[model samples]
Target chain A: MNKRENERNPVETPAHDAAHDALAEELEALRDLFQKELDRAKNAPDDAALPVKDGAPDAPPDADEGPVCACCGAPLTDADADAPYCEECLTQMRTRPVHAAAALFVLAAFLLAAVGLYLFSDSAAQWRQLFSAQRAVQEHRLLDAADRYGDCFLMNADRDSVSLTGIKAYADLCRSLGDVDLAALLVDARFPGPLLKLPWNARYRALLKLQAQFAATEQVAIDIFGAYDDYTDAAVYEDVDAQLCALRTDDTYAPVAVEYIRYLLMKAAGKPAALQMQQLEQMEAVDDGCYTGYYLAAMIELAGETGGPDAARTYFQTAIERNGQDQNAYDAFVRVLRRQPAPDTAAIFSVAQAAQANAPARGKPVWLRLFAVSDLLRGDDAQALREMQLYMTACYEQQLSLTMEEWNLYALCAAAAGDEDACAQIETALGSAQLKLSPVIGRVRAGTWTAAEALRKDGGDIA
Target chain B: MNGIDRVIRVLTAPGVWIRSFWVHLLCRIWAVPVTETRLFQNKATFGHLQHMAPPTVGAAFAIGFVPALLNRLLALLLFLSSLLGLFLFRMTGWVALSANTLAFWFAFSLYVNTYPPAEHARRMQTMLRGQGTRAQKILLAPGTFCCAVGSFLERRGVTFLLACAGLAALVLWQGALFAAIARWLPNLEG
Candidate 1:
């Protein structure tokens, strides 16, 4: 088999040897030619003389060659034989005296034209109307302001920035006057069918439709939504609450009722936590899918404030059982657990495990981070380090950045796990400016520090 | 550079080149002698002009505004005429559409090239800080500031992108407006 293979692929056949010999001869010829050229170049004179054609020396042109331009070597026309430079060159060299007067006249003409065009422009009219509307509002001439604003909108309803500004101003004026019908009319006229087709205008169109719906019903709902800008006024909240209560039982208005309740909870000051919790529960009862995880989180918070951490934990546990997919419930549970005088690490770990199991692809990093934190709190440094690595890998997969606090936690875990290389890598990645817990990392590695103490020193909350 | 960078450079070259030509022309008219002119891959350069006197803010403003105002007027005319022909006249066919497209591209190129170069802006700034009268300064402040800012933004191609966005928005607005008018005209006749 070896003999047959060698016969099939001979290393040095006669044809190959012949081709090699031919290549070597060609290379030798080229080398000889190159050497000759090199010798000729070396033997050449300092200012190498031009090679003569047919062994003839250079000679001057006959006078019959005719005159040429002195500046450019182009043949001069007989009509301009005395001229030294070519026509083109002459024109280039010729400098016309500054036409100062003509230039100033032209400048004046352009400036006047610009000013004239601007003064009579549609944009100018729009600007004037906008200014008048603003001045009218300042002077308390609501009627004039509305008219001017309407004119501005009609003139430029297709202009996003200008039309939006005018519409917003008109809406504000109408709302201040408690004229829902007029506000609805303003939005409808400004945002016609074609304008509403634009993607950016969809929200405005929805708002207009919502206002129309509410206007068809009790105008009080519109008033409650639009007129309660002053949060400090007890009278405003009382009025809003009264209107919301009246609409609470109507299924058509339940979403509005829920929104106003959430708004009041967020904006209303000095309201008792128990009352807030009561309102939240009422909102949830009538929510009709309008209830978000945020409301549950708020309820948990209020429960913790009014009924202590145990109550909050119960509420969070109930929320998780009701909707395990709700990340907010897990967050609230972890928060409430961590706030205890002595946190139950086992419970925290279990909640984190449940959260990780239920988390969507986007939320996995957050849950993994929570798991790492729980392990760190449990004093299982190596386990925490492993969890942190997993968390970072998850974050990388999701293209999410680790917060400064998370970086600090990772460094702490690395130090406490006695992984010097990992600690050094973290320090290099974070830089000294961002690694606020650098001093504490060393102490934690020395077994004289804790993650909670490092967090405290770095002005980060343990929770 | 990468493909997108090369494409952008190619796209922006004409505007810069035209602006350089205008600058050189304006310098000559102002009695500054331009010794030579040279064109490059993306920009043009003119030989240094002999300044008889320090450039005044007013002169700088006029130099910047003349070509810019002319170009803006031409662009606006082209834009409005195209809109009218397409919507009101109901021009159809590839011939009309191609004409309108060419007009639109030309108008866009002219608009992009309207801003003065950075040298004019620097001259304006120096004169504004040094020797201009308060009334003169006040009168010229808004125009000069806009020129300076436009110059800066143009170099980074931000102005070109903004102009493109504005044109897109304008086309959409005009389309919507014409559609609404067409829909309403029939109802009113009925």
Candidate 2:
């Protein structure tokens, strides 16, 4: 039958449908046998449910020498085993434990972070809470605000400086609440202990700056060196001194500098006399006419204040030497000299000489000679004659001319010498000069008319 | 009164005559080039007589060290002063600095004989072994501070010496401490 079937295969090749049918029948028979065997094996389970002498099962029903399920330690290598996870442990391994654990950890971290965020969200929440706590004390709620800040320090990054600022705010609030001691305590608490063991310059500066900020305007002077109980920092004293000195030295502050310098010295050095010494030194050092005359006067005044007659005389004498012709300095110097316990006379002579030496060239350079003449007129006849002789020499030898006032002095000198013609000549010049003088000048020239009276007559002091 | 009589009264005033005389004298002194100040000037030299000249380093040192050494010698004469105390004497730098400058140092040594910074400890030695005209680091010793004597000769002279000394000492101490720490924490080397 196989030989004839084999021979018929050629015909099957020739007809594809018949050959396909034959092959399908063979596959069906094999499938039927396989299904029967699988059914038998499935029905004949539970034979190896063995117990040991210890009354425990020797092995699991599906145990075999192979890799087991990681979750239940069940042998899972078999291709066709009922309940592949050994029936009892099938539900355990399929779930996602690693992923779930990760999710749980992340959730826990999120909750912690959220809690932190809520605790220290912003100053707004703290502000609200404090505002609600209305009390007699002004902003007594600041204590609570401080407490909130302290809580934030434990959780937040960048805490140190923030905490310090909060502490300062608390201190300010306490001060506003009329709790000065508590405010002081707040400052103490806020100071960084590790960094500041000795007296801290920063703290001192802060205190001074604060004083400058809050002091009552009426209670404090605008000057840098004004008296204040809290102006204790050495650095502050130095800074203020420097600032005031800078202002005094500045050309812009020059017109008012004299007054300010006096005030500054009186406040800083606590001695009005120091003003004189400083002014004298500055005058000697300065090259410009920036308050030169003012400085001389200041020195005189300082000497007067300190009752240092000798010092006053010396300063005046020096000023006279520099610019004796400048009536302002001479007058002020004379005033100081009068204030002395004992006035210096020689200084007047030297000042006169200095003035003569420094006088402007050409016509009647006699301001210094006049100072000498006045000194001579004050008492010393010999000195007066000597000054007059010197003046005459300079006038004749240098071809210099004398104005009317200078000629008056010459006339007086001639009268002393019994020279009638010179006196007459001076008198004629004086008369002519007087006649030619303007109304204002004529009024000033009249011995009876004061400058103020002349100014009143003119209706203004303008030239 | 007559002008001559008035002039006589001015002449007789107590300070006036003397001041005027002094002014004339000052003027005379000022007129002489020999008496003129040579400070910050080029005309000054070893041979010439000058005025108000900048102090030479040797002269400054001599002036500073003489009085200081005298004071120290006096201390030695009185009692066997602590060598350290002698070095820290207040008047040790008085010819160059201020009086009462070493009160703090003396007090500190007496009460807390704690180890001073290395540079502070080395100050006297540096002073004794000075170089030629090294610039002053500090101008004046404070009431209580440890600064090198050499620094007092230099410009920008206040507290700079002490600070520099302190910094050097701190660096040395830190280096030593770091070495010890390195040995202790071997793992940190990595």
Candidate 3:
């Protein structure tokens, strides 16, 4: 206060007191001016910090009853203005109930859940159909498999509607069966346009084309050989004679062309074996050495008995040479070699070793198993056991479902190697001694059988 | 005094008796029901202001509709003013060198406007701005509280009914304080 300031300064004399009083009054005026400036800057009203004019209840309370906010004094004359108090201050005084906001949040949440459930239902039904089709296929009901798969095509044949789950399920099933061409035949006859709209539809088309050629070949084979169980089981036997003439025309499908040619050779029988030989030469000229090509080469030797020992040897050698990364070519060529008169153990062992050398270069697990059998036939017990172990490990790595016969064959390998521990591992891995076995496997188990019996009865098909 | 003797003394002079019974309460601001009670010696000392106090308080509770609401609005304005004054830069204006000047004036309006009679109004103004008796200060508490309650009752729905109830309670409460204050009137006049 100015009084306090005067006391602190201690100015003396009437003139000094008068000067101090005058200065105090001046300072007081400046202080008031500063305070007014501060209050105005803060948007505080003029009387905002003032009390009622004391001892004057007689004075008019509102003076004139003009518009002035009785609360925070913002002007109320402009557009969107409110009197008595500004709109913001007045709203602060009133509280609305919270239940309306709570209702909105719940409604929003329910709508979100409804949308999510709606989107998921379509894909979920598609998945369920695929699973049931797999179940039917496992049950050996081919008609049911085709029907369920057809239902899958109906759910979404549109490219935009197809999901990764559908494509992956189809691809995995085909690859797991290891018979893309035949399995496609069993699941089709639906004209496949919708299936063609699917991802990886090319694989399906290729296999399907292979399947058609195979059907044509089967028809021709049935006409010549009669409906032998080995030749025909899934199709009509009587249609064979009606379809035989179709084989004379050149087959367009690369996969089953060899089979079609073999049937043509059957149709050409006694028409001078030279003509049949010329047809085989022409087929070989166009061959690209896929698994079908090498298998057809071996089949050519078998179809002509007079191709002789050297010709048989040449075809088998060439088949093994043209095998590339696939396991099937070696399997077919070796099977024929094992069935050879005075079976060529040395040549088969050399071929198996060369294929074994290709093992690390993306070679198939089936090649290792074939080599193990080759090693066993060559009487190399340790090499056979090692290759067999490698084959089992490779099967496990590839998630290949091995059959009971393969399990029994592993048991035989263990027995031949004289390793009790290896035999116990096979039993433990198979989880039961009462495993399903083919009769040939039962004969091998009885210890009165040959290695050829175990090798040739590779019994995954029955299981 | 002993408890029984004091109780008897209070019972004799009903005006002072009612005032003294509230011993620990220590202050009396409201004028007693002067015409209704035997003030004996205190009645002779009555000035026009003293005579008007009780009637004025009764009329105040009855007439305090808009005034009561205005008093509450004043209190709200005072609070906002004080909040700004505290938070903002504190360099002084000539009039605002001291703090709460608006609040002091608002409370002054509240006290004066809510009392409704000239005499009570004057005394209410005195009590707000100047340091008065301990009794005067204590009585202001209920007086302000009654004003606030009466004010809030008129803020929204069922205004007439709730305001009437609030006013009735305020009148009775104020009458008691007035009675207690009146207990020493004769003594003060001497």
Candidate 4:
């Protein structure tokens, strides 16, 4: 059957052979070309192996043979290997026309946004005015600054940083211009609650109000309290004695008189003790019920300085007799006792016990701390630790920071109790505050010294 | 580049991309033909434009001016809002705190990207030098000067440093103000 078919289609057979020959020849030619290109690529230098331009006669036969430009499909040079596009494509892209409609759309959007923001949000304008005010202040243009600040205050009443800072700055400017009343008014109007509670702000307003009530000649007395509040130069208080005497006649200014006298007594480091005692005496004579604990405390301090430990003891007895419930008198007596070369721990413990029994809830931390100190002095480490724990707890409950001496005593007690962790923590706390354990406490922490040794060093009898 | 410069470039790469995006976007808005936009490695380039005419003063000024203004406005808004959210809103718990922190980060990023790139600033300088009215030059002079200075500083990474210092100062000032108020105010937790 095949022979018959071949015989019937003899012309078709030759034609098919001819077509096959042509196809084979073409395949052979392609194979040879590919081989030659592969050879050339192998023989080429590193630079020559770079991406050849598309349609170039010397282009690599296969696209996958090497890296090519992402944009143009040309083989990339070694230098351009890291680059996604060839230099030509990059150049072409650089010159490409931007979409005009899209560009206009974006431009319109931005313009609309700018306009919308300017119309809707007044913050930008307020901030600009605020900056202008700050600049005016820098240039000493107080009036312009004040005006700008006034504008700011009217613009925003929120207690944000900008508003608060503006309020503070405006008040400062008003004060600088000698318009204390205006400053007070502005602060009172703007800061309703917390800001007015600050000591300086309260004092500033008080001074202004008091000055308004008094004549210009009597303003100096009000100024004295202001100066004292501000910690003005001590020389300003040089004639404070006469000032207090003048202020004492007015019952309204009696508190001021008492405060100045207390200041004089406490800060009278270089001044003669006799002068401070006389002032204290004057305060006592004019005293109202406000002359409770602080008066007795100050007198005890002065008495210790003037008449020795025995005299201080006598004053303490008198103070206790005057008011056994006053925590400050007991605190002062214990402070005086502790300062002695040989502190009477028994007496301090007894005094602390009495103070603790009589002290108000607010005054409990003071007595607790004194008890701990007395226990520490007596070398009763366990009792001292227990007392200090109570003292610290009481202080924490009251939200009070420990005084420097209290911190020292706490650390010493911790060391005497062999609490390394507490000692380390205490050290860290003190170190962060730029303070260090006292030398005796440091020795105790290192285990080189004992509480008895510390007592002996301080001339205290261990018994 | 030195190691520090390289690190700074890498760190500021996102800021550079943001700035370039603004410039390109603005270019399109002005109908200026941009050839290409390339963001690779630590570099970002918005291709040259086919200026149909001598660049207008408004176009030149707006190209750098608008983006810078927006960046500052956006940053300030974010910063103040974050501060308000943290303090005023009295938002408690870690989630609100985290959100506020993220806002602060975004605000700082925007502040760092406030200045245009050196190329955009150069383009601005060229347009400013081109023919324009005397009044236009006087009006745009400050903007031009600021762009030049900002670009100069941005190249040297000084703007990044300045942004950091400025953010720190803002935080410290706000913290001090809030702390002072909080000291006397009733407990927010309650």
Fnat of every candidate, listed in order: 0.01, 0.00, 0.00, 0.03
The lDDT ranking, best first, is 4, 1, 3, 2
lDDT of 1 by residue, A1-463 (tens): 2222211222221223445778999999999998998888779995563354565555544577888866578998865565554556545533533334334433433443343343235344664565566655554445556667777777665553243445656776665444555666776765445555788666556556556554443455556668757655787677666666666566455354445454563446558878778777766674433234437777786787688778898888767655555566776666666656577888888888887665545468768767876877787778888988988898889788867666767888788778889988887887755544456667777778666555435433332
Residue A297 Cα positional deviation in candidate 1, in Å, after optimal superposition: 38
TM-score of every candidate relative to the true structure = 0.32, 0.20, 0.30, 0.33
Number of the top TM-score candidate: 4
**What is the two-chain DockQ of model 2?**
0.01
Question: lDDT of candidate 1?
Answer: 0.59
lDDT of 2 at A165: 31
lDDT of 4 by residue, A41-73 (tens): 999998888766767967556755777876678
Q: What is the interface RMSD of each candidate, in Å?
A: 24.9, 51.2, 34.6, 23.3
Q: Flag regions of model 2 displaced more than 4 Å.
A: A1-289, A294-311, A317-347, A350-386, A392-412, A415-420, A435-463, B1-190
Q: What is the lDDT of residue A225 in candidate 3?
A: 60
Can you list each candidate's DockQ?
0.02, 0.01, 0.01, 0.03
lDDT of 1 by residue, B24-56 (tens): 566556543333334343322211122222244
lDDT of candidate 4 at residue B58, scale 0 to 100:
75
- Chain B TM-score in each of the candidates: 0.72, 0.20, 0.24, 0.71
